[model samples]
Target: MDRTLTDIPTAPTDRVYIVIPLFNDWEALSLLLEKMTKTVAPALRKRFHFLIVDDCSVTNYASLPTDTGYSLSIMRLWRNVGHQKAIALGLSYLADQPETHTTIVMDSDGEDQPEDIARLLEASAQKPGQIIFAHRTKRRESRLFRTFYLIYKSVFKLLTGKAITFGNFSVIPPNLLRKLAHVSDIWNNYPGGVIRSRLPYQSVPAERGARLAGTSKMNFVSLILHGLSAISVLMEATAVRILLFCVITAAVSTVVITVVILLRVTDQLIISQGAIYIVFSLFIVILQAFLISLLLVFIVLTYRTQSHFIPAKQYGDFVEQIEKVY
Candidate 1:
């Protein structure tokens, strides 16, 4: 059904904003807005406002229809600040608004269900200080994409010791939103920061929907980079494992070499053959180098606090301007 902003209900004090971070998916965004306005619960209809952050879209926003009656507002960032950063900007904007008490962030492609908004709101109301994330029970993506996502989720859990099976589709309470606003590293790590925060959060299972229109903006390279960025949060954990591996390998090599030498000297047999000695020497040298490198990494990490090592400020600014029109 087509909608003009007038179709949406409004109240002076009841304020809830839905933030859709748009990149190049203008067509998909249009359909998403239509569905949201027409299908969302009436109780949620009155206070609902829609904020579209055009992440430096190459297309002109003026060309897009804005007849939807909901308090529609568009913030064209100076440039494309990427998906996560764009969402961060939207959250910041809502948090600053006196009327906005709850904010929902979702993708513009319509992969997240609009009907789930009510469920998230109910969950948020029950847990006032929590963030309600939409957890997908079954993903209607390609086999390759699903496989990669599953592997990535497993690896992330193993490294970070945190479970994150969801993405940006979430309803954040005002209190939690305030806390997130104060977080300097939110854009850089995106969902990682939310998971690491260990804040009170709940998840509602939502059925995934097909894209409303247009191709997805996320390419293979972008997905890989995002995955790496998320895993970077567990660098400390990976470094410790590397250090332990290096030390154990070095110690085993040393013990083997010493035993070989002692057997050659005390026994009638020449246990330390030339080939054996050369192989052992090379192994020890390589292991020692690995150990030294890990030691250096440990020293650097020790001197730098978790926040400093990640360099949240620089990362945040980089995210802030990713789509800024040049």
Candidate 2:
């Protein structure tokens, strides 16, 4: 099968780095690298250096071919920090490097699509200073997974006051790499952290590709953790939203309790014995809401006071070794 891919204008002397995070997906990654090597322009062939962040993978692509035009470097971590942090580590590593070039952060799984790299680079070439994210136009997840994912997006928007229309597949121009490396949010969720970075960024529509190899690692629990990590990046905003809701609940409860008491005392309405229980319940609700609001305030303040996790200064601690295979 043949597909038309628009080529990006990269200078012949340009050094393009593609950073991919891996976790027990060596076979998928190998296929992805092969696809990229085939699809990229001839002048850019040897210039493309792959930075693979191996998140303590149990399996290995030990039989890696040596005749490929591109160079490959694997940064093996001492322990798995999950895919999101693995990406954070990879980008941080690149940020520390002296070379100033565009780096693309993507997944080892083929779902991110190697073909979309051109679109990312094209967007970068056009918009030099801004980071470009691959806004997925289509998803291939199961109906059940999509339903839950939709729910997650809705809640994320409602809580954070920001809509997330993209994910990890993004292009980070050289200028913004060091700045993003210092942002703490990347430790929790790369895309969410990028959003929180408050840096200039734009999105390009790219369809999600099917998995090239093994079964997906995502599950109900992983989905929840992923969502929570994203939300955690904007914890201050989420906490404030929750606090406002609690305050509103307390005020409404108080007003209803007052109305019930007035009716009970004034003989304006025939209040039964249940009226007392209703008043008591409303009072309890008010107390609970007030307490919750207070706790949220304390938490938000505490979070603000604490130090943030800067990835650049700490990424090396997780990396066990770096292997250059061809």
Candidate 3:
């Protein structure tokens, strides 16, 4: 996953737009945009468009120095809805545009690496229809950050029964873009939603790069919420698993209660004093577990019945304005 930058690959003749979600990271974005302008060949750069999703940043978009050589645009949201939603809205916006053939989603911070994008593009070419994911083989983060990230991945797999190793960085084909626009879960978690979408996708091993500018905005609390959001998209599966656990706990408690009862009736010493407490505890456990299982069943049913927002349908509501810079 430790990658050495090679000569920039020739971009496809077809038009491609790169979508990056920005939240007060204009400095990094400005540098990245400029670097991309110089790194990519002129003809190739012409075919590429930069779509910046300003997630209601406090800084004025106009203040950020623009590189006019590359085609760039900014989509400002009505409110800050976090990075995942910003990416979702951006993808939704592009799905409607006529010129959108391939959409690449990446973070404005250099952690996603502008150079790796060419690798993503190359992977997309090998398999024309399949979505290409920039899978992380190694991370350039602190030990604590990496540890927490690994734990998050494990918990995600345990709850959702799917292993997600990728993030926002990926290549979306024209046909798949349409399908993804309708998937509501993408609004919460991009990679998780894509996994649930059941679309064919392939992952190309890529190394994580250092941030280009300021410190990361993702704190511990934010990381927890982000992880929960990903898990939330797979709520149905999680609910079922919880229900199953409850059922198993109830069953075990029931057996224990029956054993305690038999012991109380047959053995005088067993029921003398503490036997009542044991029986009562087992019964309480069974009742609580059973009730929880029942509640989860109802919750899952309600969730299924609810009408969730379809990105294709509701994306426009969040968009404040779209400005084409160059």
- Residue runs of model 3 more than 4 Å from their true location after superposition: 1-13, 38-43, 61-69, 268-272
- 1 against 2, candidate with superior TM-score: 2
Question: 2 or 3: which has the higher TM-score?
Answer: 2
TM-scores vs. true structure, each candidate: 0.79, 0.93, 0.90
Give the lowest summed-lDDT range of ten residues in model 3. 1-10
Prediction 2 TM-score vs. true: 0.93
lDDT of 3 by residue, 1-326 (tens): 10111122343548788899999998888877777766666666677777899999998644554552346778888899989999998898888764447889999987887778778888898898999999999998788988999999999988878888988899998889989999999989999899888889989999988888889988778889999999998988988888888889888888887877787777844445787788788889888988888888898899899999898888888988777676
Q: Best by lDDT, which number?
A: 2
Please identify model 1 stretches exceeding 4 Å from their true place: 1-10, 61-69, 248-326
- The top-ranked prediction according to TM-score is 2
What is the descending lDDT order?
A: 2, 3, 1
Summarize candidate 2's per-residue lDDT along 219-264 as a digit string, tens digits. 8889999999999999989998998898898889888888988998
Q: lDDT of candidate 3 vs native? A: 0.83
What are the RMSDs of all candidates, in order? 6.0, 5.8, 6.1
